[model samples]
Target: MTKLKLSFLFLSVMSLAIFVACSAETETITKEVEVIKEVMVEAKSTLKTVQDRGTLKCGVNDNLTGFGVLTSGGTFEGFDIDYCKAVAAAILGDASKVEYVPLTASARFEALSSGEIDMLVRNTTWTASRDRDLGNDFTATTFYDGQGMMVYADSGYKTIEDMNGSTVCVLQGTTTELNLDDRFTSAGLDYTPLTFETNDPLQAAFEEKRCDGWTTDKSGLASKRAEFPASAGGPDSLVVLAETLSKEPLGPLTRDNDSNFYDVVQWVVFGLIQAEESGITSANVSSMAANPTDPGMARLLGVAFGDGKVADFSFGVDPTFIQNAISAVGNYGEIYERHLTPLGLTRSGSLNALWTNGGLIYAPPFR
Candidate 1:
């Protein structure tokens, strides 16, 4: 063969091999791009997920007053509901953008575990078993309560011991149920357990005298007592026994495996208490924001300094988020007064008071 013919053949083969190699490289690049896009789509945190969803799904109690209750106007009201609203304000920038799911004590955990609700704001107790066993996390205790028994004031039973052989009505799926059994058995008292699935039935049975006593958190008993029928001798007809059964440290709950969402919730709640401690209220929040001089206050409200640098704690929330929440619902104390105070519950000298005043409602510093 001629030298030119041989050289031409070799060049053609080289070109063909280069074309195949480039085609393979392009195919690999396309696959990697697709994978990266998929990872990006799946990498969203719960905060972002909630933002995209446009509302916070909160699990709450629909039966109890001073904590959670549905009114005749078809709206949720009370302490737990306010906390849900405050959380919604902080995260979604609108307190009204919330879906309140009324749940029973037995159903609250299941709703949270299954992602049916983003959070549990019902008066749920934080137990060691619940904390360690369930794939969930508990934030600061919002309300400090204890289990107690309620009976007719004229029932002639002054104490739990005096009620031996009496039938007590109680919710079936709650810490109250266990406490009732434990206290009665330990006290060597014989009492019939009238278990109920929900509060309506329990309240109905109690009103109809189907049970001699009603057992629940002391705060719940107060709520129920406030609604006692005039035909049943009015609210004074029911009296809560003084025996404290269990420490019901109630609070909000979040699911596990999402650290960002947890941090957001934890800090927002603590911030409410902190705001109250700082004497910041909805009425004066605007002035504080406009002329923030306190380092902590300025930092919390995201006030820019002379150099235009605002404090960044990396919480993934707007600096104005806490202020907005406070403005919408006031601080924790305001929330309590608005709902609980009317129920004949006082914060002073109680477990729900501030830490400075010898109570458990305290907050961590923003710094």
Candidate 2:
């Protein structure tokens, strides 16, 4: 071809290249704009939503005693229930501002993710899958528990080994079920599991001797044993075996990606723990706030110490939020003693004891 024909073809090709590059750049710019818009539409923080609603919707277990239970008098009370109240008091300034939604083991995570509850304060174990796959943020482990087996005292069951080839009753959707299998199966013990979705039926079955053993968190076993009725051979008839199957660090959980609400829940737990550590009781919280002894105490109580400004974390609530929580439910120790001690789950030698007491219950610094 001649030079002129070649020049014309080159110009046409150059024009086509410029048009393609502009089109790609324009597409990229449009995509970037869409992303910016998507980023601009942020999810409303659960904190502001709860504040505006004037109540905290807390998911809890109504069946488990000493943790969360609906009473015969139509009121909810327990170790977990108190945390609900504490969060409510901290956020809404009224502990009674909580609406407790009773949830089963399987349904609790759904309730939280589906917005059926703002937070879950049931005896939920913090697991890797739950924190990551389930889209949840576990606050602190309020109670350190382990799975145990409760058997008829007369059954002469000394340990898990004794329960070989026995039928065990367990909650269907819990770590307890998994742990029970792990224990018995790993021990090379053969057993049949009688899985129930709720406690009442399981308790009834155990009462009728349908299952050779009942198993759950030791705290749960103690709670059930404490409330064992006369018609069912009473509390004395059952005994929790000494073998602890798994480490169940139970606590409250909020929806994932909700950092504001998660932080509030997490720190409320820490504050209560700090309150106990600082010797601030519900009875003396008012006095302590009025006169905090030191900088740490003053910061925790959100009070002025010797004319210093109150330490505020800007948690989207009043600085005295911790004080409100403490006033509502007392310290972590008080809450535990009020609920768990009566069940005979002593805190002195357990993981639930304060870290200072050589237990796992430790809180991060408030400041």
Q: RMSD of each candidate?
A: 12.0, 10.2
Q: What lDDT score goes with residue 117 in model 1?
A: 92
TM-score, structure 2 vs. true:
0.88
| TM-score versus the correct structure, for each prediction | 0.87, 0.88
Top TM-score hit? 2
Tens digits of per-residue lDDT, candidate 1, 1-367, equal: 2347546655655565566567857665556555544444335356777888989999999888789998989999989898888878888889999999999888888898888998899988998777778878898798999998898888998889998999999998789899989999999999999998998888889889999999988889888899887986789888888888889998998876556778888888898898888888888888988887677887777676455677877767777778878988988889988999999988899999999999999888887
**lDDT of each structure?**
0.84, 0.89
- Whole-structure CA lDDT of model 1: 0.84
Instruction: Determine which window of 10 residues in candidate 1 has minimal summed lDDT.
Output: 36-45
Lowest lDDT 10-residue stretch of candidate 2: 35-44
Residue 349 lDDT (model 1): 100
The sequence of per-residue lDDT tens digits that candidate 2 reaches over residues 50-154 is 998999999999988899999999999999999999999999999999998999998989999888999999899999999999999998999999888899999
Model 1 / residue 273 / CA error / Å: 0.2
